[model samples]
Target: MFKSIRWRVTTLYLILIIAALLMFSLTLKGFLEDYFITQLEDNILKETRLVRSLLKDEIVSNKRVKKIDRLVDEYSNEAEARITIIGSEGKVLGDSEQDPLKMENHLQRHEVQQSIKTGVGKSTRYSETLKINMKYLALPVKHSGNIVGVVRLALPLTQVKEALADIFSRVINAGLIAIIISLILGLSLTKRITKPIERMTEVAGEMAQGHLDQRLMVTSDDELGRLSYVFNNMADKLKNKINEISDEKNKIEAVLSSMGDGVIAVDNIGKIILFNPSAENFFEVKEEEIIGKYSLEVTRSHKLDQVVMESLEKGEEVSEEIEILYPEERIIRVKATSIKDQDEQIQGVVVVLRDITELRHLEQVRTEFVGNVSHELRTPLTSIKGYVETLLANDNPDSAIYKRFLNVVKDEADRLEQLIIDLLDLSKIESGISGKGYEAINLNQVIEDVLTIVMPKVSDKELNLKIDVPAELAMISGDESQIKRLYINLIDNAVKYTPNCGEVKVKVYEDDEKIWTEISDTGIGIPSEDLPRIFERFYRVDKARSRNLGGTGLGLSIVKHIIEQHNGMIDVESEVEKGTKFIFYFPKVK
Candidate 1:
């Protein structure tokens, strides 16, 4: 059976209460008994003293024995006593309640012998004549300086016994009442101590049942109160710690669930503790089947296990991109990190797998593109260098042909310089290290200035330039020079690439959230497949024609970075050989 705190406390309280009550009852009983006996003895001694005083003269003259006996007999009945007169030899001479003549020698009686030997004695004894317990007191009678006889008196102690019995009854009744009161008080006190503890027990039990928000209330500063205080503190701390852990767990869960990559967590013992949706999908396993199982068994990826173990042994983060071979022979990039504690101990490992198959393909395309750009730029550069070297070897350095060759060298030099500068600018932008000074500027003025600077190029290409900007065009926040550079790069490319009589148009508009601009040109368009990589550094579609037209593949890349620095986005739409359009969104000025 289960015994609760209240019951145990009540039982203990009752035990202690009973023990005390018994002791008090026993002590009262002994004291009352002694009191009763002492009172009886005192009464007996007082009677003997009074009677002996009355017999003093009679005893001294040695006369009136019968008269004295008669007198004793009369008063003894009133006194409620037994009276006896003894001679100096301790022999009974007269008795008030017994026949004096028939009485045996009284010398052996304790009271008579004591009076004879030492002048007085008192005792309690059983009386044969009365057949009851009685108290006896004796006093010596002195005559003419000689002890003549002793007058002894005895009284029945029945009244004293009755009075003591009455007291015992009262004491017993009082003790019973006191015990009852003590029991009530003890139970009440026990309840006080145990009630809170009992509540704590219940709350703790609830906590064990997964109600982690359980708490305790404090009531006093006694031991019980101290216990309660401690209990409440413990509960509060536990609740806070659990809440903290729960919140962190929730945050981690949110991140893992929403991520585009797969995440898996394993404990130090190589057992899987956490696996997100992506991981489950990637591994083709359910979370229920994988959790609490060995990572090797669940993931079947030895590369991941080896990485985790290495990170644990080194007590550091270990990263390795490995292909996880699935049941279908599909591969993925797994990036693993060791989970560490505040003490720098490796507690577990987390692996994030990113599917980069498309990115890998793009990388291959970029490599081929760079090679093509190299070949395209080198052909023109090599031709221009060969023509200039040939012209330099001639004797006539100021002829018309020489002038034409110098012009060609100058054009090629400009083209090469533009290409180098564009590449350098793209590198700076992509690396997030653009050194252009930044400040707020009127976006309209920047647009006007770039258009004016590029008008000559527009005329040279016989292209029509259209500007449709409102007077209230939103002010832009960026480096004014970089903004100009950004516009020039885009406009120059449009004019240079567009066919004669083609239209180069620019438009600006605003919505509640942002200001946007679009630059559309009837120029050579890019293929849909290469549209995504157009903003990549050193990427060009028509590489040979772009080099001949003084094009640097970095123009679009720099534009991307400038927009990014202004916290904007750029999107492009193009049709192969039909037209190209670039859209940029920027935050409106405050």
Candidate 2:
């Protein structure tokens, strides 16, 4: 409770008020007691004087002791006091409230001795005879210029105490009233002072909770009001600064979230502090699960950990291509850089991972393509060169020898021309330069046309070409030439791979949503591993056989590209030595 400013203020106020009231009560009570005692003493002294005056002449004239005693008692009763008359010999000659014979000597009495020396004396003390506290006054009575006796009077202090009690009660009551009033006023003043401070405190708490718009109300022009104004101004500046920071932070987050490259940030202690969405997807872990965990624990990639550590230790950027196998097998190019502060101190490490699997695959394909093209051209050119050289060397050679060499040259030349054409076609399709001149093409008609073109080769092989196409199949959206090429590639590949007398089947049909086609061949079926890559350009399952059969090895690759250009899907199923089936689906026209 004392932590509260208002409570402390009110408590201090109450303490001061109570202290002042207590001091005032003590001082006032003392002053009143002294005054009442003095007045009572004075009244006792006056009554003593009267008793002495009444007895002075009588004592000088030797009046009866009994008479003096009666007179003293009369004066004492009238004054409501005790009176004593002592002779010059310090003998109590007469007394009221006590017999003179039983009384002690008066000369040694404090008041009597003082009165003898100073003519009058007064004292306050407990009286043995009265058995209570009393005020005493002593005075000298003289006659014929000689001291005859001392007259003393005493009064109990009970009345003075009663009067002081009454005054004390009144003072206490008034003090209590004043204190109550002060308490109320103090509470009001404290609340007024502290209410604004309390409000500012509350607003500051809200601001801490991210409610930056919370503000204080300045209701006065006092110190607290000025403080409120300052606090509000500070809050405004803070809010704007926070907003600016938040905007910048949001922009950074947006860039990170939208990035295709995975980004992970670790602190100086090697704990993961940030993990973007791409990083989560790349690592196959949730950000919440891995945040604040050690980088090595989450990724479990030695290369990734080494990259980050090397960057942090060397305060330089490190990059490497690393393969991850957990989520999926992918080649990722990672660039790790050490983050620094203005002081150029290494604060953490930031790692960016770009997936380069496709790029790497493309690079390998290009290398193989160059090698294949060189080999293919070399063989044909070598043949043509050999044939022409033989003809030139054979002077007066037989016509039959010349004709056979020329024929061999022509065949090689034709193969070279066909390989060049296939290369150009595959290049155009892969580069997305195959122009879109689409039309509604009949699937059955395209199949029939492709069959007619390959019928001679099928007949030479004696393969059973079975056609199961629906005569009235739905029309599909495609370029007519590309569709015909797609059919020709499928049927031609089947006939080339199948041995003599093998069965080749072509089927075309339609479902509610798509046109479907399947080509099956009883050929040397592709292996499971090779099936995935059979559609790559220049890839051949049986290289020698493919070349001998006049295949350029770009047929299946072209077929795939054509299907994709028409937004169709193609899949292949094969079993070694059993058969292979190529199935394709194209969306049907509404």
Candidate 3:
């Protein structure tokens, strides 16, 4: 309830009024007190001066002290106060209420001392003689222009204190009435002023809840009424603006949803403000989770965040490719563009992210394929040209030399032909141009056929080739020729890479829903870092050694493609010096 503006304004007025009253009361009270005391002091000083005139002649003579006493006693009643006469030697020569001889010397009195020094003195203090609060005034009796005696008068302050108390009582009563009246009128005026504001507040709250039609009523032509008029106008404009903004928002949302590339936008301080549905997969989190998070927290890639930060700080566009390892390993190409206002101030950064993992892998494979093909074909071509040119330059040549050169040229031609065949076969398998070949093929039969073809090479290396074939394994859906090529590549790779007398093992088995194959070789083995790209086209662990072994370098890549076509999965494990293993599984045919 205290949070309301009405109560707040009312409380402020109450506090101000109370403060003014307190200050005014204190000031008036102090003025009255000083006025009362000053008037009393002046009246007492005048009486003392009158009494001084009577005693001037009697002060210097001891014989006249009685006369002085008689005179003061008579005037004391008239003045309505006690009176005293003091000699020059500080002796109390006469007193109105007490015997002159019984009274103490007046020398130590503050008022008497002041009168002797300055001709007039006044004081108010508790008096022991009368046992009451008293005001004292003293005057020097000037005779022959010399001070001979001081006449002092004392007055009780009971009446003065009573008058001040009465004045204070009257002021307090009046102040109470004023406070009550002011509270009643002030509250009414405050409510009257705040009523229009309250109506406008209600309308604004309704507008917040999407009821923009709500408006204030203009009750008068005063400031609050005019404010109401402006408020209604603002409500109308706000309603129209909200409609337009909603339409724009819907369009933006539609565009972001349909986009294939992921989009993320952050404010100038790097808190995310916009995250599209497409971006959820890239970060492996829903848009709601990371909408207000930093880019590094969502992408977990510092390189990608650097692009965003650079775009924000420099107000320029930045692009980078970064790798993410969650949900799967992938390469993301991100482009961060600075969002700006009309004045060209950076407001935030918006980033478009494209998943380029496959694209990059494909490009790398294509580049390697082109280089490998050129090297393979160019070497043989250059040799053939060189040999033919030599035979032509020598008008006559030894037959054996010519035949040996011809044989070397033929061997080069064969190598070039083999590389071309492998390349074409891989392309056809990947492109699906020759149509998919689906048939029920036994895994055991395929392995046996591949072993027969690779057995000769296995024997040449003196490697021990072992096979564990289930006599009747499950058949899988695939092409017979493709499956044969897949096994031949796996087995040949195992045999070729194995050192002399190294062990090569092959196993074929089946579970309820699929058939599985395992091929492991105790060869030189592959490095752990090279296992991921081992199935990429033309990727070789040792290029010179692969060429020497007559490897076209497309065998493992082709094997992977054939397996994928058959709806299967393959995995590899390897150590640098121990061995390598290739395990694969194919879905069973219904």
Candidate 4:
């Protein structure tokens, strides 16, 4: 009950009313007691002085105490109080309320002792003879400048207490009535005051639950009503601001999801706050699984974490290329920049990652291609130049020496010519300049054209040739000349690599949608590691032997380009010194 505002306010009001009643009752009670006692003290003091003068001569003359007691009783009856006569020897000579002989000595009495010392004294205490609370006043009786006896008067406080009790009873009754009336009125007022507050609390709760349309009712023009007005305005503004923020958040999410680059955002503490879809693809982790984790944990790249930290701490942009080895070795270009607020304080860091693995591989391939071309051209030109110089220097040379030098120069010139032709063919294939003439061609016819060209090499090697061209093989769509060249490279390689009496086999068949060819050679095979880059231009497994065999090293690269142009795939399976097999597939003409 106390948790609600109504109960709490009513309880507080009741407590205040009770406290005020108690304070007023106590203050009035104390004031009346002090005023009555003070007035009694003054009236009794005057009566004491009058009775002192009345018996002064009798007490000084040493008259019998019985006679003095008679005079004291008469004075007490007139004053309506107890009177005591004490001799100068500290002996009680007469008492109006008791026998003088039976009473204790009055010398030790507070008022009597004081009066003996200072002429007048007053005190209030319980009187044993009267069995009531009494106020005592004393004065000295004197004769011829000597103290004779003390005349004292005592007033009973029974009437004073009765008067105060009547006043207390009346005040308490009035106070109780005031308290009950105030409590009833205060409870009603508090309920009214807190009703609007409770409504505000309900509206606030509704807003917390995403019901921003809830509003408080303004029932009055008091402070609470004005407060309700302000609250309604605040709710309107809050709902609008929240809607705007939600729209902006959705827009940002759309942009991030569509981005090709991986983006990660982190707070200044280096925890992952945002991970986009591209980042999920790059790291192979789900966004929900990795959010709130550290950046290093998600990317598994300490270098990226360092760049993010550096950007966060220094509030600067940092760009770096980091390598991630898990899942695969990928080169990622990470660009980290601090996100700052309008006050220019760093709030977080945003790191954008672009997968540059393919780009880096292309760059390396280009560099090697240029280098290999330069070397290839340089070797043949240097040999031809040396041979020509020898011919020029030998002015008186024999015919045989001139002939040998000229033939050597001619062979190098032929090598240079073939190299140039291969280079041109490869350039055309890569640039999509070749293979534009598409037609339905028979696979066996193209392979026959290729085998006819390589017949001499096969015959020279005296190798056994195996041909398994299925007569019913389906026709495929491609450039006929390019297909012939593709077969020529494979068959020529097989013929060149096979030992004397070794076998070169060619097989052609068809699958559901493709015409398949398998070329297997029982000759020296490629190593396992070099299989990936075997199709790259100018890449030679056995460079010296290949050059010696009159091979241009561009054959396989050209073959790969031709197969791609025909919308086909080529695969190689090779084991060193055992055999090598080339399988290629081209889509059948629909």
Number of the top TM-score candidate: 2
Q: Residue 175 in candidate 1 has what lDDT?
A: 72
Worst lDDT 10-window in candidate 2: 57-66
**1-590 per-residue lDDT for model 2 (tens digits):** 88989989998999999998898888988898888887887777777777777788866655477887888788877888888888887877778898887878888888988998899988889987879998889998877678778888888889988888888889889988988898899989999998888888899899999999998888889898899999989998998999999999999999999999999999998999999999998878999989999988988888889999999999999999998776688899999999999999999999999999999988998899899899988998998999899889888989988888888898889989999999998888777775566788887678778888999999999999999987688788878887888888898889988989999999877888998888999999999999999988778898888878888888998999989988899999999998899999999877
Write the residue-wise lDDT of candidate 4 on 300-369 in tens digits: 7888888999999999999999898866899999999999999999999999999999999999988998
Candidate 1 residues 1-590, lDDT tens each?
11866667666767777787788768877887788777766777788888888887877666677877887897688778888888777566678887777888887888777777787777788888899988888998987778888888887778777887887788779877877887688778877877887788898999988887777776677887888788778888888898899999899889889998988888887788888998888778999887999887876878877876776677666766676676544456766778889997778888777877668767886887688569657865997989878887876776888878878878877777777676666667667665666667888898999988999988887888999999977676777877889889887888887999999999989998788889999988889999999987667788778767776677887888989988999999999778899999888778
lDDT of candidate model 2 versus the reference? 0.88
Per model, how many backbone clashes are there? Answer: 0, 0, 0, 0
The list of candidate 1 runs beyond 4 A from truth reads 1-270, 274-319, 323-385, 388-401, 427-437
Local distance difference test, per candidate? Answer: 0.80, 0.88, 0.86, 0.90
CA RMSD per model (angstroms): 13.2, 2.7, 12.1, 7.7
TM-score of each: 0.49, 0.92, 0.52, 0.63
Candidate order (TM-score): 2, 4, 3, 1
Residue 472 Cα positional deviation in candidate 3, in Å, after optimal superposition: 2.8
Candidate 3 whole-model C-alpha lDDT, 0 to 1? 0.86
The superposed Cα distance between candidate 3 and the true structure at residue 485, in angstroms, equals 1.1
Q: Quote the RMSD, in angstroms, for model 4.
A: 7.7
Please report the TM-score between candidate 4 and the true structure: 0.63
Clashes of 4: 0
In model 2, what is the error at residue 334, expressed in angstroms?
3.0
Tens-place lDDT digits, model 3, residues 70-132: 988999989998999988778888899898988888887999899888878777899887899
